[model samples]
Target chain A: MLYLQVLINGILLGGLYSCIAVGFSLVWGVLNIINIMHGSLIILGAYAAYFAFTLLGINPFVFVPIAGVALFVLGYALQAGVINRVMGAPVLITLTLTFGLNLILENAMIFAFKADYRKVIIDPPLGLIEIGSAFVPRDRLYAMLLALLLVGGLYAVLRTTRIGRAIVAVRMDREAAALMGVNVPRIYAITFGLGALMAGSAGSLMSVIFPISPLTSVAFLGKAFVICVLGGLGSIPGVMVGGIALGVLESFGSLWLGPDYSTTIAFVLLLALLMFRPTGIMGKRGFE
Target chain B: MTGGRLLMAVAAAAMVGALPFMADNYILRIATSMLMYATLAMSWNFIGGFAGYPSFATAAFFGLGAYAGAVLQTKGVPMIAAWIVAGMIVTVFAAAVGRAILHLRGHYFAIASLVIADVLREVINGMTNLTGGGMGLNLPVLKIDVTTQAQFFYCAMLAVALLALATSVILDRSRVGFGLRCIEQNEDAALRLGIHTSRYKTIAFSLSSVYPALAGAVYASWVSYIDPAEAFDVLFSIKPIIMALLGGAGTIVGPVVGAFIFQVMEELVWRNFLNVHLGLLGLIVVLLILFLPKGLLGIGLLSPRGRPLTAKAP
Candidate 1:
């Protein structure tokens, strides 16, 4: 029963992780820029949620879309103005540019908010639910369900919408897409905006369960990379499986090998996976 | 290549060789540190700038050398012997590791190198009995005149820098150098051209590790103390790449110029803008990447203008 409970907790946490990583995977798959600033942007969303909770008595569940929209605008302008200029440079240049953006964002947050850990805590909405000798927190249950809904919505938008088809076409061949009358730059902006939205939503959801601090970005960045790599770029189902696997592995690792070492397990898994299975599980577009 | 160039090269070498008499202890210390780092950047350039595989394992090799030097020094081994032994150890390790891992492309290779650093750190931390674990190890400072000792290290480092530059120049002109360039341009075509791609890559990777190992050994001798965190710093691994990129990669003079620029800016930042130094530096790097994609040398700039000398028949 206790083991089952741990497994349930892992799956819930995995859902949150999947949400955090999908935006990153989407950006990498479409833009071909491994935006190192992603974790910093997620931190921005968490802070936005925290402030919303503090000032207006708004809960995280309500604040997520607000934060998501705000971040979408920020991400859109950033990509359109700064990042798009060097879109054709080597991968190293792209990596370095995002790294610089990360530094700016992190320091700006530090200057504004001070380096204090903040959390959005809500008084328990309702009592815990028990099913077959396993217990689940009401907040975690909601976060997990929300993750599923958001991913499904995103998947639908990409598959069914005209804009979605343009994005897919652009991903398939940017030059050909432009030749075919698709506005390539606009599609790029939309993808950046959408990726940021997912990160913002994940950040808002995550603030409730984890402490929000500037430095937490590094761990989340590592986690997102591990999750994305495991699932493979351009593979949505791969992310779901990857996220759950990482969460469970981390939970069991913490339980068995001591807590300090649990964090390193993701990085270790990432290295091993890249070495052994560079294509990633179910990856449609192989690694560059 | 004629009289003037030959004379300039000889004059520069002579000045560095005679620096022990003119430079003060403080200046010599800085020079020593600069040479060590320059060596590291050049080594990193062999794989990263030239081979087009950005590695993050220089720190691992450096830390490995430091620990090896520290252990050997504690056992009463001479300084020169410790440096050579440490370099050889890291060279062998790099060859073995690179054979298996360098096949991973792009950021996968970069991140794998990072993981290697972390794992090396973990292994060192776990082996408390050999490494003194987290606390680190100390070496007895050799009895010598303070001024001359500093100057000696400075000259020694200059020699290493010269050697590194020579190696790069040779590799740039050699068949292996041609092979590396072809591989960098396109691995599939290089394979079709019968360039034994993995063999060349592994050789480049192994050669790259040697300079960091030697420099780390020299650093241990200079500082007389070391720790796992300081030895295997991720920032240390990053600095050389930044220097290489800033100076203009894949060129002999680039890393050298980059090291000089980085050290000067770093010193200024430390002195003037203490809190936001990294932030500012980050901005500079981003701006460079966006605007000056070929870095300071402006290699990419030539393509747009299509000037007679710079233009290629692409």
Candidate 2:
């Protein structure tokens, strides 16, 4: 029964983890920039949702799209205005640039928010549902469902939409995509924007479950890095698999080794995966 | 080296050496920090600048050195011997770890190196009996007066910085240095030319690890306290890279020059805008990368023909 409960909790947490990594994976896949600012961007979305819930009397779930759209604009402007200028530089340059951006965003949040951890309390807190003697919290279930739905929406958009095809085209081959009349830089901006949107939406969902603070960005960023590598870089479905795997592993790991060692275990797993299978479980050769 | 430049270098060194006599405690402290960062920046240059490996393992080596030194000190080992022993331990550890991870290119290598510090911090935290875990560890305090102690650490850091500088000068002209440069330019071509790319890289990685380890040991002793969090702070890894980039990576004087200027700027910014100093630092980094990717040294003063040292083939 305990094992069953842990499994359910892992699955629920895994869904949100997938949502967190999708944007980061998309940007890394398409832009080839690690987007170190990603975790902070997610935090920004959480703050947005928190403020909306408190000030506007809106549920965080209802404010997800609003947060996403806001972050999408910010991400688009940043990539187009700042990051695109160094599009041709070495990988280290871009990585450092994003790191700088992350510092700015995170510090700005710290300055503004005073580094306090805040959470959105859904009024009349939703109770848990019992399934075969295992309890599933209603809020976590809702967050998981919403997160999966967003990921599914993203998949559908990528499969069917014109802009999504342009993003895919750009990812496959930038010069060729440009030759085929695609606005390559614009596509890159859109991809970054989409990534931020996903981060923001995930932030909105996460705000209810986890305490929101600027400091948590590092942990979130670390998880995203591990998940993206685990699922294989740039693969959407791979992120889902990787997220669930990590979620389950961490669940079992915390149970066995105590919660503090969970991060250490995840990092050890990352190092092992990086060493033994650089291509990751679901990643193809070229992507690695 | 040209006689004129050599004389100028000696003059600069003498002036820095005389700083303890002329400056107050605050200035002496800052100078010591500058030397410490200069050492870090130079150490980073071995692999990051010359070999083109973006390693973020500086904090890992540093924290390990601090712990090793702190632990040894607690065991009643003499301080200088502990520092040297810590350096050896980190050098061996880096060589082994470098061999394992050096094959990864670009982002993969960067991420792998970045995670090492985090892992080390966790491990150190878990070992409560030896490390003191989160509660922290204390080294035996020296019985000297405050001023003498300050002068001692400053001079010690200065000596280490000079040692690192001398090594950089030698490495910049050696055959292994040439091999590292070639590897940086094109690893595949360098390998095809019969160069031992992996060995050179591992050598560079090990070289980069040792000085920072020694500095970490010296720092642990100086502060008289050490902790997993303080020793393994990621900023220790990042700030040196920024300083290296700011000065001009891959050049003998670049990291030193960068460290000096960055330290001054940091002092100024930290004084004026304590609240937003980090954000301002980030803004500076963004502007620096966007406008001056080659750093201050890349502005055509150091190189012949007025070409930036890092300029790629057109």
Candidate 3:
């Protein structure tokens, strides 16, 4: 029963992580920027939700779309205005630029939020569902179901929608996509915006269960990178696969080793994956 | 390269050399901190700037050096001996890891190096017996008076920075330096041309670690205390990269110039704003990346006769 509960928890956590990582993977795949500022966007979304709920007395979950829309604008403008100029520079330049942006976002959060740990208080914070001998938290189940829905919905749109096809085409080859009548710069902006939207919503979902502060960004950033590498960098389905793998590994890692050592598990997993199979579990070659 | 310019540079060096005799203790201490960062930037430039590998393993080697020095000094080892031993240990470790990580290019290499730093921090934190389990270790305080102690460390850090500068200058003019540049331009092409790219990279990586290790050791002694958090500071790892990029990555004078500018600005920001300094620095770095990708030295306004540092062409 204990083992089963842990597995269920891992799966639920994995679902949330996949949603958190999808935006980052999307940005890295298309724009080829690591988007080190990603965690900040998520934190910003969480705070946005916090304020919306606290001030207007709405459910935190209800305000996710608004946060997502706000992040879309921020990410789009940032990509079009700043990141576009250095698209052709060395890879490190773009990475370092994102790092700088992260510093700004994180410190700005610190200045505004005062580093106090904050979490959203849903109307029913903890409701449990018992299945045989294992107990499932209702909130975590919602987070998992919402994660799958958003991720699955995004997957379906990419397969069916015109803009989604254009994003795919751009990801494969930017110049060729432009030659094929796609507005390459606009596509890049939309891709970044969409990624930010996913990150923002995921942030809202995470805030229901976890406390968030400015300092939490680093841990999130590391996990996003680990998942990106694990699930395979440009693959949509890879996000879910990588996220579950990390969640399970961390689950068992904390059970066997101490919980404090759980953070290093991702680094170890990341290093091992890069050394052995850089393409990742579901990642295709050339794209990675 | 002009004799007149060289003479002026020598005169400036002599002035800095003579500062401890005239300047107060506070000035000397701040100058030492600047020189310490200058050393870090210089060392980072060898691999990150010249070799074109964006590495974040600076804190790993730095923390190792600090720990090595702290342990040895506490065990009755002389300060100079402890510093030398720390440098040697870090060199070996850098050489080993560089071999594995140098194969991964672009962001793979960068991310892997970051993991190395984080992993080292965790390992150090976990070893409760040896590392004091985050409670931190304190070195035996030196017997000298405060003023004399300040001058001693100031001279020590200046010496290390000078040594790093000399190494950078020498490497800049050497065959290995040219090979590093070639590798940076395109590693495969450099290998095809028989430049021994991997060997060159490993050597550069080891060389870069040596100075930071020495600086870390001296820093441990100067502060008279060490901990995983303080010794392996992530900001310590980042500031060097920013300073190197700010000044000019591959040039000898660039890192020193960048470090001085950054240290002074940091002191001002830390004093006045206190809370938002990192945000301000981050904004400047973003602006610098957007507008001045080549950095201060690369733009060459300070270059003798207004010449660009070198042809940017690979």
Q: Let me know the TM-score candidate 3 reaches against the reference structure.
A: 0.96
Going through the candidates in order, their DockQ values are 0.47, 0.62, 0.60
Which numbered prediction scores highest in DockQ against the true structure?
Answer: 2
Regions of candidate 2 where Cα sits further than 4 Å from its true position:
A285-288, B1-7, B304-314
Q: Please tell me which predicted candidate would have the highest TM-score against the true structure.
A: 2
Model 1 over residues A1-288: C-alpha lDDT tens digits? 878888888889898888888888888888888888889889999999999999888999888889999999999998898888777665666777888888888888887888899998897564689989999998888988887677767888888899988888888888898999999888888889989998888899988888999888977887888888888878777777778778888878887888777767777788778879976787887212
lDDT of 2 by residue, B226-289 (tens): 9999999999999999998988888888889899999999887677998898899899889989
Please estimate how well model 3 matches the true structure, expressed as its whole-model Cα lDDT.
0.85
Give TM-scores for every candidate, taking all chains together and pairing residue i with residue i.
Answer: 0.91, 0.97, 0.96
Write out the backbone clash pairs for model 1.
Answer: none
Write the number of the candidate with greater lDDT, choosing between 1 and 3: 3
lDDT of 3 by residue, A131-231 (tens): 98998999889988888788887788677899999988888887788899999889888988988898888888888889989889888889999999999
For candidate 3, the C-alpha RMSD (Å) to the true structure equals 2.1
**Chain A TM-score (model 3):** 0.97
Choose the strongest candidate by lDDT: 2
Worst 10 residues of 2 chain A by lDDT: A279-288
